[model samples]
Target chain A: MIELCKVTAAYQEQSILENCSLQVSSGEHIALMGASGVGKTTFLKLIAGILPPISGTVHVSAERISYLFQEPRLLPWLTAAENVNLVLSDSEKTIDEAHHWLEVVGLAGAMGKYPDALSGGMRQRVSLARALAYGGDLFLMDEPMAALDDTLISQLLSLLHQYTQGKTMIFVTHSLEQAKIISDKIYLIKNKTLELL
Target chain B: MNRRWLKQVLAMLFWLGLWWGMAVAVQRPILLPSPAAVFLRLTDFIGQPDFWVIVSSSIWHIMLGILCAVILGSILAVLTAQFPLLDLMLSPLLTTVKSTPVASFILLVLVWIGRDSVPSIISGLMVLPVVWSNISTGIRNVDAQLIEMAALYRLRPYVMLRRLYFPSVMPYFLSALKISIGIGWKAGIAAEVLTVPANTIGKMIYESKLYLETTDLFAWTLVVVCISLFIEKIIIAALGRLDIQHGRKVAASDD
Candidate 1:
């Protein structure tokens, strides 16, 4: 579903990745594991069409992509349900889908609450619900569950697997256990390069 | 009412009590009218048809000015935010407007436009820079990560504005309104006073001063202050309601 050939990216004078390459087949789940600030997010951004590589080609076959940011990034004025519904094209089905996703995320009671009224974990779940309600073939998540608790994490891991079944997903995480649970293949970001594991 | 609003009301009453004490000490209605005297004068003024005509005209002109300024300023802000070159070109001109004295503009405007239009024009001019700058700042302050996500999802422009920009920019816009409305009132009245337009509070004030009716002058001044405070309180209350809806304080500086 995605390919990056000899990608070279930088932030001003400093290089984040050099001579890096990655490829993902259709419906394959991939995890990029790394320490803090190792450009895992950058690589994901490259595939997600947010960051253009300095000197490489990135190709994404999937036309529809849903992204969950590290921060919840919910609109402060929007209700939790509205936040999810915003991702969908206007339809009666969108409202039902948004409600369903909120229910799946354990926020059925919070549909009317704005992001400001939500706790951190609840906001993150709202973000996750937004991504899921979007109904895309490609999913890119950057440390999406970082703010979640262990119980919530396990619940979401199961939901993520169910929702992302037969879809291409690229996620970044710090935990090996999380990577193993979600990803069919794992890659570590280190020394300004992606190392297959 | 909130505690903060109650506290502000109490503070104003304390100052008013001091003013009443000072008026008692002076023991002269001409030099300094007592609060009761001013209140009585205000009641009489309110009952007059001429006073209503003047107040209503002033309200219409100033509100029109502010509306025009807000519309033009928001358009300018969006243009400037979208284009750096426009921002670069307009920065100095806006800064000049900000830095120049209000009296200077009023004088020049009085020459160009008639006295009837001066108050409205000056009020609009005074308000333009405030709305433009604050809205531009709000646009610049939008979160980068959210933009990235927005791009990845391919949100439509109107949807992007509704879902992102409105929430982010509303507080800044309200803060700009809170500040610029006062400036508009001040500039509008100053223009009216200088031009001596008919059916205006400023004209009444100018006439009272010319005839040495110090009590009337004090009364007019008190009316202006009261009206300004009332309008400001209403705007701030509406803004507070918006803050409650959005779930975040504006974080705008009071000044």
Candidate 2:
């Protein structure tokens, strides 16, 4: 469940989101579509409690949150599996869990490989694996499938659909097809406010 | 064997030959002892029981100083990075410490602590500023995006440290250790030479100089160099093992 009543977010003098309001019930998957520099990432950040609203209020009623950033943001020092394991608890089981997620993301062979050794798509999948391994009720993803091809994106989307069942999600993307596939409702950012389509 | 190894061996032999020629020309053992004489003196030292004791004692004192400096420097770096006021206050003091001569610190510490403790304290003082500056910069330079991801996941404090902070700061920490170890060890020995602590290599060097035993002085100085190199190799080996175990193969694959 999420709620935002007239949330005005800004970075110093530059306003990203102005007096924007939105509400989503539990288990709702919402897609946010916006042009470049249009604050789609800012909206996700606001919901994930990364950025504070300059003037209004935002609330997210979730026990845990998993965020997939635009960039992979994987720890370069950690191997692909180790990067996923970073979000998991320290246990033998967690190692297996990390491996499982990496496998699900089609990175079974790359489990021992470092981020630097992996391609851009592979790295992004590793980041996705990490987010999925975290196992959160609320998922905030910013263009998570941007690096993958259409076939891979479809496969991953199906996997995501199964994993995120009954979980609340706020996905940001430019692809209308992806927006339709992953989200129950679609909202576009226009003129500094969320416009439902 | 290989080209590089052959080149290195040749270079070493060339230096040794030049040193032998100079000693033969001088023929004054008091001013500059022959290489063979110094080597024989070192062999005699190696056979003595007192040599190991002296070597171990110096190692203990300098290592203790280095360890203390590492711990305290890391803590201070974290604290200063967290609090701007603390950073403002510590900036000038650390800069002063960095710029101050090793002999100055030795003298100042001599007035406060006993002769035996002077080496440890002086070495710690010598190392602290470098460790602090490097680690503070590392902390400040951690990738912001990774930090945001860590926060979003609500990672435990210790987990965050082990996973995020440690890896991010490791290169800087290792660089600080490499630089500061040499500086600290040299400074510690200098302190010992001044203080003339009992049963130390520094004390033996001083006594050798006082008695005009040039061969003994050269032998003791060689011991110092050998030990410094040995310690550095051991540390680098240990850190390399840690890096391997942690899967930090970035440096190797960086090229």
Candidate 3:
């Protein structure tokens, strides 16, 4: 289980989360829904350990945490396969493992292609493959499929559902339908506090 | 490669024809050696044992000096990017170096260093400002969002450099390298000529000029041009290889 106790995080003087508290258990998918710029991404960042709270405690039982950024931050110089390979260990075995993940993400044919040659949906899939291949127990995603078309987004969501069956995911999105599709629990941000529903 | 080769060959032939026409019109070897005369002189120089020594020595010094300058300039750029105070402190000195005439520096270096080392020193000095400015610009222009992404991922320092910084700075760095190498060659040779460094191409050119050996001077000039072009080709090829080895294909996902 992961728990946030009295999490108070702010940017400069602008307080984004104030005394925000939440709990997530293993095998649970939580959707954090809030309007744009209402600190949803900030909350995910804090949970990812990318940002430390001003005064709070976060406890995680997961061995590893992998974050899928809102933007697909693939290195431009690498082919899709090589980009995934970079995050893997240098040995041939680890590389083959990374390539397997690319295939799992439905990027098998596109592995040797550069990101520029891939569609937006394809790029996101590569990013998704990278995060998942890291073998993290907990996945923190900030709008991972926001750029995809409706059909592509649905396909990816279904893939996520199958692949992340036993993993814990704390994903932020403004799409209520997407939250309903993937999340077992929903945390909606209103004003400055999270309202668990 | 074929397209480029054809283009370059055509351009060279056109220029060579122009030079030949000008030489014919002037009809004075002292003023301008004909293309044929220069070719003959080039063959004569090739037969001399000292010719290879002079060319190789100058290449050695210039290459070493430029390499050192590039390394130092890149390190300095990284430091300055991290600390603004260091940049402010060094800006005046770098600007002075950039603004100063190459001739003045050549003369000063001749007095300060031995004649043999002058060309290398001059090459290093000429390359520094060009590299520093370009690298600093590259550092400053790195995508802010990528840095944020690196922060979000908690990327290690070396990982950040490999994934974020190197790809961003590469184009600017390559361009700076191109510009710096050309300038370094000219400045290094000029320094050598003025200093008359023994067993150096610049010294050979100086000797030819002293004896009014216009054909010899032209031959040496052609040798310098060929070497410079060769170096440029090698550097560009290396840069291309780096792009491939480093795997810097631009991602479609960039905002």
Candidate 4:
């Protein structure tokens, strides 16, 4: 379960998400939809605790949170497999787990390849694999599927439905079809506020 | 086949041809030695035990100075990057060292320190600022998003330094090292010449200059160039190997 009570986050003096409140029970999938520059990404950053809200109380049942940024943000110097391995904690099991995740994301054969060699969709899949590899209770994705084609997006959505239904996920995206496909609940976010749609 | 080696050979031949022509125009071995004269002098010097002693001594001091500079400069760079106030305080000192003439430093060190220590001190001082500035920039310019990811993941300090900071800094550090080693060799040799240290390459060059042994001077200069080039190649090759090793480790970890 996660709750953002009267959150007010801003950059400099300008507010992006102002006095916004949201709550998601455990195992709930919520999609936050909004137009461009409407704080959709900002909200995820706040929830992920990367940015502190100026005025708010965020309560999370779980301490660990996995966030997938809009960009893959994979280290260019690291191979795709290494990027996935970076998140795992267990030394003895990390390699096996990384391999498992890579296979899960259909990147099994390209483990030795660097990020530059991979296509956009493949890089995003690697990022998704990294996030999933972390195995956090609350998953926060900030428009992770924005770069993929419709076919890849549908495949990713289906994968998301299989792996994340039993876990709490707050997905922020602009695609209404995607929201309808995977989200148990969709919130029409606008003007630094959310209206349940 | 690599064109790089061919280009280098051609360039060397062109310069040698020009030098030969200039020597011919001068028409006096005492004034300027031809390529053949320098080569013969080089062969004679190579056969002398004393020449080897001088070359080895100068190389030892220069290499030691470079080692000291690399260690201290890298440490200082890391410290200053962590503390802005320290960086601010140290910036002027680095600038002063950088701006001060090599001859000035060599002369000053001669008066204040032993003749043997002057070249080493001068060489170390010459390399310090180059290393500091380059490494500092490298640290500052590390990918912010990767750092954020590391922070978010709670990566251990050792892992973060090894995996992130070192790789990011390697390229900058190598560039600085190449520049510093080249400059340090020149400054170190110059210091030796000025100080006239016994059993050193600079002393040989000084003796040759004083006696108008132009061929010997050219030969010693060739030796210095050869040594510097050799060291630079070794350093670059070692850095390349390290890069490959780092890449392999990262990949292996993923598997």
Best model number under TM-score? 4
- lDDT per residue for candidate 2 within B13-85, as digits (tens), equals 9988998899999999998888899999999999999999999999999989999999999999999999999
lDDT (Cα, 0-100) at B141 in candidate 3: 95
Q: Score each candidate by Cα lDDT.
A: 0.86, 0.90, 0.85, 0.87
Worst 10-residue stretch by lDDT in candidate 3 chain B? B246-255
Q: Candidate 2 — which residues are off by over 4 angstroms? A: B1-8, B25-27, B250-255
Task: Point to the candidate with the largest DockQ.
Answer: 2
- Interface DockQ of candidate 1: 0.40
C-alpha displacement of B165 in model 2, angstroms? Answer: 2.0
Clashes of each: 0, 0, 8, 0
lDDT of 3 by residue, B111-130 (tens): 87777888889999989988
DockQ by candidate, in order: 0.40, 0.49, 0.31, 0.36
- Global lDDT of model 2: 0.90
Q: What tens-digit string does per-residue lDDT give for candidate 3 at A1-197? A: 68999999986578999898888989899999988878998898778776789998977787777778887887667677766765665345677777898998888888778888888878888989988777678989889988888887888899888878899998888898999999999999878899987
**What level of docking quality does candidate 2 show?**
medium
Regions of candidate 4 where Cα sits further than 4 Å from its true position: A89-93, B248-255
Q: Extract clashing residue pairs from model 4.
A: none
Residue B212 in model 4: lDDT: 87
For each candidate, give the TM-score of chain B. Answer: 0.91, 0.92, 0.94, 0.95
Worst 10 residues of 1 chain A by lDDT: A85-94
